[model samples]
Target: MTTHYLLNKLRQENPLVHSITNQVVSNDVANSLLAIGASPMMAMAPEEMEEVTKFAKAVVLNIGTLTTEILEAMLIVGKAANKKGVPVILDPVGVGATQFRQEAVSMLLKEVTIQLITGNAGEMAYLAGIDWSSKGVDAGEGKASGREIAERVARRYQTVAAVSGKEDFVSDGRMTIGILNGDPMLTRVTGTGCMLSGICGAYLAVGGKPVLESTVEACTAYGVAAEIAVENKEVNGPGSFRASLIDALYNLSEQTIRDKENIKRYHVNKSEEGTNE
Candidate 1:
């Protein structure tokens, strides 16, 4: 299915997305999901996690503010989602910052059959086991390009992976796509990546196409919305831009996505490298 069609399906279906995410971005994540016509259920209580996962069409797990209790809850939700065949999107935020975060991510990957993984370059690089300089939640510097990191992560985990940066890259082991439509202002805001992960859940829940295609569409749609948000003259800074971004997501049109989308496809070599064409 086309990206536009998938987006329409999401609005029409209004799937339930159970997001067990960090406290820092829970509100924004829910708002972003709502803006995209998805029902967001930010249920973190361990008692309700399995029940919520059963009802959810998708589950998003974010390790932004990792804690032992949160990790346990994520595992419960993720396992339940897997059993129910609900798509699960994982965002390993600031994973390289601490051994605890790394261990948490490792445990999640081992226990859950993740449908898609979304994060910045550093996070993806850490998952891909590449050498990258990480500073907290930031992407930091990496020798491997975002496309390479995304592809490696996908192959390593046997799942689709999306790396967000100046340009966003999505891969499902074999093919990788790049989206260049976002603005620098996105970095200035908190929870933008977290919100994008929630949006990814929405798209995956719609599920008309392959997981890779859905993920690529999600990243493209988000970047396009960012571009639209930044174009508003009233958006003078991150604060205004954040508000405008929600508005953009709420008003995002298929026509706008088609017009503004800057996507490029790359073929992945079996040698675990991506060649842009």
Candidate 2:
């Protein structure tokens, strides 16, 4: 799937995305949305979350830096999105890292009708009820691939799932897509996953079979931006990489995503264990 078309569409439409994200990358999320031509509203106050959801085309829920109040707000907005039929994208930031985190993620899932769940390998495995390891607030040690777990959870929940690692995987129970165009440096900086989830929400807002296509395009768009940002050696550190990433996003063009996208996709093999099938 080519990202060029979707990127252009998102830019032209400038969808409004309401985010109930962690404090760690709220600023980065907002900036990434702006760079990609989407308008973002970071509304945490429970009093206004429902109202905010009413206006947004889609909603993103992240648990990187969760608070009781933030969780409460998420419930409000998530329900509102469901009632309005807007997509709800969930980012299980660190599900297996702590009991509290796991419980919170579980609670949220039980309450909301999630349209998508994006996370790393460890988080995806744990959420799928498989044993996994994690390092405080970070993806833990695990042999279960994110792609494998994403497909399972997505199928079970009847929702779209994206598991990001060296190769990112996106699935909606039937089709499974693998995107391989990101720079490893993305992991060094915080909130890239969060930003990707927000971007996915933006794509969901646009509507169509295009939702999955939009997600694949967004991932490629981000990877291409990372590739472009790392082209210069002098700016190698996180600080430089951060700015360069934003600049890359800001200057991203349709041709660039289409030209640089390194995505491979196929159907799952039903007989294979722990495989997308």
Candidate 3:
């Protein structure tokens, strides 16, 4: 696929992405979207949620700071996006942490028609209704491979699934892709996963592409930026690396993203054992 072509289209379109995300990562998400040449609008008011998503290119619903109020708003906005034919990206943060968290994720799945669900392996497994070792939002361990969990969840939800980790895996049931381009430093930073969800929102906004390809493009672009950010000699720690990550996103060229991304595409069947596609 011509991934960088989509990157260029995103830059040119600069689509408006409506995100109902956590307050903790609001600035990070907003600034990262700005750097990537996409507009970010963070609106969580129940009264305005549906209105804002009416014309938005994409809607992002995150459960990082899940509350009953936000949950209701997410449902309203998700329906609005569906009505408008706008794509919705759902981030099931901490789905394996507590009963409340699990219930909240369950409610979302039952209500909204999510186009993409992005999280770690534990979160993906939880969404797939399988057992996975987890505490808080971070993953502990899982019997299934990230690809297997992602594929299962995608089929179960009938939505694209992206399991982010050292090796990010994205699947839309029929096809799965492994992206090996990010930096380990991404783990040390808080809300980076949230930021990645934001990136996915940005790309999904500029539609006219398959959900799997759009998601893979977003992950690859974000991963390339992270890789370049850590390579900088001055970025010696998480804080600096985080800041450099934004700058790197702004300066990244479409040519570089196409040439440097390490992507492995796979075709998955009912058994979930994938073959190189």
Candidate 4:
């Protein structure tokens, strides 16, 4: 797949992405969408979710700062998007950390037919019923394999699963890709994952590519931008890196994506062994 083609298509369409995200990262999420050339709207009221989702190209639901009221709105908007056949992305941030979080995420999975779910390895592992470690919103030390977890979760939910870490993984159970092009500094800043989820929503909003392809494109573009941001001498620290990252995103071109994307596709035989042969 051509990374530049999807990026170009997204810029041309500028589809509206509706995000019902956490308060801590709402501003960053909205800005990230705009920087990526997507129109972003943050609307979560139960009264307006269906109306907003009826016209929005994609919808992103995050459970970072979960609340009962917000949960209700998410259900409303998720179902609304499903009814319209609008692609829905779920970021189950900090799942398995609390009982309510676990229950909420499980409920959403059962209630909505999510097109994709993006999360750290820990979150994905939990969704797959694997034993992996997690702390706060970060994926902690764990024994479970990110790849296996992603594929398992994708199979279980029948949705595209994306597990992001030093190396990002995307799978739909049958096929998976390992995307290697991100800066470690991304973890230094809060809400970068949330922002990435927003980017996924933007790329998916264009609605021309499969869920896995759109996801890979979004993560690749973000990783490329982060690489550029950290390499910039003017970027002194995380704060500067954040601004520079956004600038890099704004300046990201189709040529750059075509030239710099680092992607690896993984497929398994009947024995379930791959990426090694």
Candidate number achieving the greatest lDDT relative to the actual structure: 1
Against the true structure, candidate 2 has what lDDT? 0.83
Off by more than 4 A, model 4: 271-277
Clashes of 2: 2
Per-model TM-score versus the true fold: 0.96, 0.94, 0.95, 0.96
lDDT of 1 at 190: 92
Better of 1 and 4 by lDDT: 1
Q: For residues 81-199, what per-residue lDDT tens digits would candidate 3 score against the true structure? A: 88888988999888888888888878888887899999988888888877888878887797889888888888888889999988999998888999998999999998999999999
Per-residue lDDT tens digits for candidate 2, residues 160-199, read 7888889998887667889998898899998888988888
Better of 1 and 3 by TM-score: 1
lDDT of 4 by residue, 1-277 (tens): 4545778888899999999998898999999899989999998788888889867999999999999988999999999899899999999999979999999999999998899999999888889888877787788878877788888888888889999998999998778989898999999999999999999999999877889888999989999999988999999999999999989999999789778889989884455433211
Which regions of candidate 1 are displaced past 4 Å?
A: 273-277
For residue 83, model 4's alpha carbon misses the true position, in angstroms, by 0.7
lDDT of 3 at 166: 84
Model 4 vs. true fold: TM: 0.96
Clashes of each: 0, 2, 0, 0
Better of 2 and 3 by TM-score: 3
Ranking of models by TM-score:
1, 4, 3, 2
